[model samples]
Target: MMTYQEAMDFINHIPHIGKRNGVNRVRPLLEKLGNPQQHLRFVHVAGTNGKGSTVAMTASVLRQAGLRVGMFISPYVEDFRERIQLDGQWISKEDLAEEVSTLAPLFRQLQQEDRAVTEFEFDTAMALHYFARKKCDMVVLEVGMGGKLDATNCIDAPDVSAIASISFDHTQYLGNTLAEIAGEKAGIIKMGSRVAIYPKEPEEAMEVIRKVCRQNSIQPNLPDLSQLEILSCGGEGSVIRYKGKQLHIPLLGEHQIYNALTVCAIFEELNAGGWDFDWETIQKGIGQARFEGRQEVICREPLCLVDGAHNPDGVDSLCRTIDRFFAGKQVTVVMGMLEDKDYAYGLSQLAQRASRFIAATPQDTPRALPAGKAAEIAKSYCQRVEAVDDPAQAAFLAKSQAGAEDVVIACGSLYMIGYAKQGFLREE
Candidate 1:
C-alpha cells in the first residue's frame, strides 16, 4: 500500500486528461470501478458561492437525523482531505492511501491510453468509491465547477438537487451572463429530483432555474425570505426567524443566513418526500455547523478575520459582514486573488471601507494575481497600499498594523485565506 504522502504525490502528479465537453471521461472510469456512485444517494449542490456552506449545513442536518452523511467539496480551505468527509469528519489518511493504491493500476492503464483523469476527476472517483464502501445514507456533493459537465454530475438524478445563490465567477467555463451561469448550475436538477433554490438569487438566474425546473416537471422549493427576520447578528453569529421558526445560525454573515434558508428549503423538499427530519433537527444541525475560511475569525485580540471571497458577489457579502460587525473601526485589509477572478471589482468594493490594503498572492495556484499587480490596482482606490508576496506574512503585517480595536481582515482566494488563517492563529 502506498503511504499517505506517496498517495498524495501520485494523485497530484497525475497529468490532466484533456478536458472533454461532458462527463464522458469520468463516467467510463466509474463504470470500470463498478459505478460506485450508482449505489449512493446524493444531494447534488451547485452555485458560484455558498454551495460549500449549504453542503455543510445539509450534511450536518442529515447527520443529526442519525444518518451517515458523506460530504464532497472542492478547493479545500485547510486540509486536502477536507474534500471528502463523513459525518463532518474528514476521510482518514489510511483510507485515502488504500484507495489510491487500489486505483493506481487502473490510473496507469488510463495514462498509457492517454486518457488519464484530471486531479478533480480522480478526487471525485475516490469520494464516490469511499462513500459507497462506507455505505453512507446520503452524500452532499458540491460541484467543482459548472454542474452539467462537472465530474460530480456523473451521479444519476439526486434525491435533492439544490442550486445555491447564482453569480458570475467561472465565466470561461460556465458562462458570462447570469442566465447562462444559472443554466449551468441548474443542470443538477434532474427529472424526479426535488429542487431547492436560494430565494435571494438574481431574477435572471432565478428565471433560468425556474425554466429548468419546469423542464423537469419539478416545482422548485424556495424559502420565504419575507418571513426571515434577523433577531440578532454580530461577529459571533446570527439568530434569525424563518417561516415563523427561530433558528440560530452559527456561521457568520447575513449571506450565511440566506445559505441556511437554502438548507431549510432543501429540508422542506426532503420532508415533503418523507425524509422525516423535523425543523428542530434542522435548527440543531444548522446551529452546530461551522465552516472555516469564510469570515472565519482566527484572532480576537487584534481582531483578525479571514474570508474566501474572490468574486464580486462574494466580496459584496464580505463587505456587508464587515459593515455590520465592525462598523466605524479602522479596517486594515489583507487581500489576495486569482488572476482570472473579478479582483478589480472586489478590490474596489473593499477599498470603499478599507483604511489600508496589503496585497498578497495566493499560494499553490498558477492563476494567482501577483502581489505587486494587486497592490497597483488597490493604489487606485486606496491611498495606502503595500505588496506582500507571502500570504502568512501579509496576515501578520495586517495584524501588526492594527491596534487593539482596529479590524484586520484577509479576504480573497480560498487558497491564500488558508495560509492567512494559520498565520492569524499564530499571532494569537
Candidate 2:
C-alpha cells in the first residue's frame, strides 16, 4: 500500500506525460478498471462555454429534488477537490488523499502497460472512482475539452445529455468552424439518450445538433424561455417564474438564462422518464448551486469581479453582463490568457468593455501568453495597458486604480481565475 505522500509524488510525476489528444488512450484503462464510470447515473454536458454553469445548474436542481448528487467539473477554480463535489460541498482532503493513494498503483500500472494517461484522464478516472464509492444517485460530468475525445466521455451513456451553447472554440482539437465544434459537442448525444439543449445561435450549430439527434434517435429538446417569467435584478442574479412558481439563481448575465432553462428541460425530461423531482426543489437547487471563477465577487472595497472568459462567446457574455450591471462605471480589467486560444478576439471583447487593462502571465504553463505580449495586443484598443509579470502584482494595480464605485474585473483563462481567486478572493 502506498502512503498518501508517495501517492501524491507518483501522481505528480505523471504530469510530465504530455498532452495526447484522443479517446483511445483512456478507454482501455477505464475498461480494465471495471468501468467505474458506469456505476452512476450521469447528466453529461459538453460545449465551448457554459458547460460548467450548466452542470452546476443541473446538479443544483437534482440536489434540490433530494438526490445524492456528485459533480465533476474541469479546470478547478480554487482547489483540485472542487472538481469532485458531493451534494454542494467540496470533497474532504482526507477522502481525496486516501482515494488517490489507492488509485496510484492502478495509475502507474496503466502507464507502464499502455502509454501514460493525460492529467485530465487521470483526474476523470479519479472522479468516477470517487463518485462510485460514494454511491451518488447522479453525477453531473463536464467534458474537459471537445466532447468526442474528451476523457470524461468514457461514460457509456448518460441519463441526460446536454449541449450548452456550442460555439467556435478548441479549434485545433474540435474543428475550425462553429459547425465542426457543434459536431464535436454532439458526440455526447448517445443513441436513445434524452438531451436538453440551449438555443444555439448561428443556426448552423443547431442544424448539426439536430442532424446528430436524428441519426442517433435521440430526443433533443431546446428549452423555451418564453414561458419563463424572467426578473432581472441589477448586479445580482435572475429570478424566473417556472411552472407557476418563482425561482432564483445567484448568477448574473443573460447567457445564464439559457443555462437555467437547460436545467429545467433536463429535469422535465428526467421526470417524464420516471425520475421524480418537484419544482420547489429545483428552484432551491438553482439558488444554492455555486461555482467559483464565473462572475465571482472577490472584493467589495472596490467591487471587483473575476470570471473565466477564455473564448469570444464567453468574453461577449462577460461584456454584456458588465454593461448591464456596471454601466457608466470606471472598469479596470486584469487579463491573462493561454497562447493557443483566440486571444486576439477575446482581448478585443474585453478591451471594448474595460476602461483600462493590466496583463499578466499565470504560473508554469507553456500555453500562457506572456504579460508583455498580452499588454501590447490590448494596447491597440485601450489607452492604458500595463504589462505585469506577476498575477498578484496585476491584481494590486487593478485594485489600486479602482475607486470606491469603480469595478475591477479579472478575467481571460481558468488558470488566471485560479490565481485571481486565491490572490484576491480568499477573504479573511
Candidate 3:
C-alpha cells in the first residue's frame, strides 16, 4: 500500500516523454486500459493560455447546475493531485494510491513491451478510469499541449470543444506562426461535436479553425466580443452586461472577460445539445470559479499578485490589467520563465508596467531559465534589475521593498508562480 506521494513519484519515474506533439503513444496505452475515456462525455478545451481558467469556469458552472463533473488541468500550481478533480474535490489520496497501485502491473507490462508512457499519459488514464468508476456526468478536459495528439485527446468524442485565446507560446513544439498553431489546436474538433472559439481570434488562426469546422461539418460558434459590455473592473472583480444583464466574475484582467464569453458560448452549445441550464447557472458558476496561479492575490495591505503569464499575449494582458486597475501606483515585478519561452518580449512588455524588477528561476524545473539570464534581459528594458535564484526569496525581497501603496507582482512560468504561492501561503 504505497502512499499518495509514493504513487505520484512512481508515475513520475516511469518514463520521460518530451512534449513531442504526438497522440501515437497515449492512444495505444489507453486502449490497453479498456478505453475508459470512451464511455464519458467530454468538453475538450485546448489553447495556449486560458485553457485551465475556461475549463475551471465551465466545470464550476456545470457543478452549480447540479451535475457530477470531473475536471482535468495540467502543470498544477499547488499540488500533484490538483490536476484531476471531481466535483471540486481533488482525487482522494486513498483513491490515488489504490488506483496507481492497481495500474502498476500494466505499467510494468508496457515497459517490458517497450511501450512505456509519459507521466501525463498515465495521469490521464488514471483520471479517466477513476471518473468512469464514479460515473461522472461529464468531464472538462484541458489539453496538455497541442490539441491534435495530446494524451487527453484519447476521448472518442467530446460533447463540446473550445479553443480559447490562441497565442505565441510553445513555438518549439506548436510552430512559429499563429495559423500553424491554430491548426494544431483545431485538431481537437472531432466530427459531430460542437465548438466555440474566441471572438477576436487572429484572422489566420480563425481561417484555420473555420477550415477544420468545414471539414468536420461543424458550424463553430464564435463568441461575439462586441456584445459584452464591461461595466467596471477592480481587484475585487469585473461587472459586464451581456444579453442586457449584468454578470460578475471574481477574476482579474480584461482577457478573462473573453474567457468567460467562450464559456458562455459553450454553455449555449451544450444547451442546444439538450443539457438543461440557464444564464443564472452560468453566472453563479463563473462567479464561483477561482484559479490559483492567474492573478491570484495573496496579500492585501502591500499588494502581492501572482500570475502565470509567461508569453507575449499573456504578458500584454497582465500589463493591461496593471495599467487599468493599478494606475498611479508603483509596481515591482518578480519574474521567472522557462528558457524556451519568448522571455525577451515578455519581460519587455512587463517592464512597461513595472517600476522595478527582480529576476528569479522556477526552482527544480528542467526547463527553467537562469535568473542571471533573466536579470540580463531585464537590464535592457528596466533601469532597476536584481537577480535572485530562489523565487520565494525574490518575492520576499519585493515585499520588503514595497510601500503601502506599491504592489509586488510575481509573473512568468506557472511553476515560478506556484513556488511563490507556496512561500506566501506558508506564511499565512
Candidate 4:
C-alpha cells in the first residue's frame, strides 16, 4: 500500500479526468464502497464561474449556522490540502495522508477488479469517505466540470442546488453556445430541490435555466435584481443588498455582487427550511471568506493584482474593475493562459488596461499557450508586449519595469497567480 504522499504523487501522473465526460467511472466505484456519498448531505454547486466563491460563502454561512461543513474545491492555488477543508481550515496533512492511505487499498482492489477510475473519480470518492468519516452535517461539493455527468454528481439529491453565473466555457465538451452551457450547469437541479441562481440578466443563459427548471419541475429562485444595490464597487471593495440588509464583501470586483447574492439566496432557502441565522453572522462570513487568485492583491509595495481571468467575460470584468479602481495609474500586466481558452479575447481585454504586457506559460495540462504565441496575440492590442516562458521571470520583469505608483496586474490564469505568489511574493 502506498503512503498518502506517494498516492498523491501517483495520482498526479494520471492525466486529469477532464476530456472524458459522464459519471460512468464514479458510479461503480460508489457502488463498491456502499455509496458513502449517499450517507452524506450535499450542497452541490455548478456554473461556468463564481461557483467556487459561492461554495466558499455557503460553507462559511453553514459553519456560522453551527453545522459541521466539509468543503471540496478544486484547482488548488497553493497546496492539494487546500482543496479539502473542515470547519473552515485546510485538512491537516497528517489526516489527509491517513485518509488517502486508508482508501488506497480499496481503490487498488477496484482497479484490480477492472474498474479503472479516473483521478477525479478517486478524489471524489475520497472526499465522500472523508466527509462521512467526519460525520459532516453537509458537504459543499463543487463540480469538476459540467454538472450533468460530472463525477461529483453521482451523489443523491443535494439539500440545495446553486448555480452561480453561466457563460460559454469548455466549448468542446459542452456545446459552443450560452444555452448549451447553461443546460450543462442546470443538470445539477434535481426535481423538488429549491435552487438559487445568480441573476443571469443575460437572455440566453436565463432562458436555458428557465427551460430546465420548468422541465424538471424544479422551483428556480432567480435573484431579484432590483433589490441588489452596489453601494461601493472598486479597490475599496463592493457593498450590496442581501436579504434586505446592506452587506460589504471584501473581495474586489463588481461581479462579486452576483456571487454574494447567490450566497444570500441559498442561505435564505436554508433558513426557511428551519435553519436559524442572523444577518450579523451572514455579514461576518461574507467579510471573512476569501477566494484566492481572483483579483487577489498580494503586494502593496508594487501594487500587484493577480486574477484568474481566462476567458472573454472574465477579462472584461477584470478590466472593468481595474479601470474603476486603478484608472489613470500606469499598470504593468503579467499574463498567461491555457491555449484552448479564448486567448485573443482575454489579451485584447487586458491590453487596453495595461501599460506593459508580459506573457508566460506555466506548467499546465494540454493547451497552455506558449509565451511566444501568447505575446503574438497580445501584440494586436498593445505594442509593449514581451513573451517569457518562465512565469516567475515574467513577474520579476514586470515588477522591475514598474514605477512606484504604477500597478502590477497579473491577469490570465490561476497558474500564473500561483507561480507569482510562490516565486516572487515569497521574497517580498
Top TM-score: which candidate number?
1
Q: How much does candidate 3 score in TM-score? A: 0.96
- Per-residue error for 70 in candidate 3, Å, reads 0.6
Return the TM-score for each candidate structure: 0.97, 0.94, 0.96, 0.94
Ranking of predictions according to lDDT: 1, 3, 2, 4
**lDDT agreement with native, every candidate:** 0.88, 0.81, 0.87, 0.80
Ten residues in sequence with the least summed lDDT for candidate 4: 13-22
Query: What's the CA RMSD of model 4 in angstroms?
Result: 1.9
Best-first order by TM-score:
1, 3, 4, 2
Clashes of 3: 0
Predictions: Cα RMSD each: 1.4, 2.1, 1.6, 1.9
> What's the distance in Å from true for residue 241, model 2?
3.0
Range of the 10 consecutive residues with the lowest summed lDDT in candidate 3: 14-23
Per residue, candidate 3 scores C-alpha lDDT tens digits across 252-353 of 888888889899999999998888888889989999998889998898768888999988888888989898989889899999988888888888888767
lDDT of 1 by residue, 299-328 (tens): 786888889999988999998898888888
lDDT of 3 at 136: 97
lDDT of 4 by residue, 1-428 (tens): 45667867866764465446547777876776678887898888998778888998888878877889999998777677788899888887677777777766776787788777778877788788788889999899999888988889887778778988877788898898888888888888887667888876468888988888898777777778887667788775788775578898888888888888888888777776666778888888887778788888777767877888887778877888887888899888888898778888888888767778888886655668888888888888887998888787778777766788889987777766788665456553
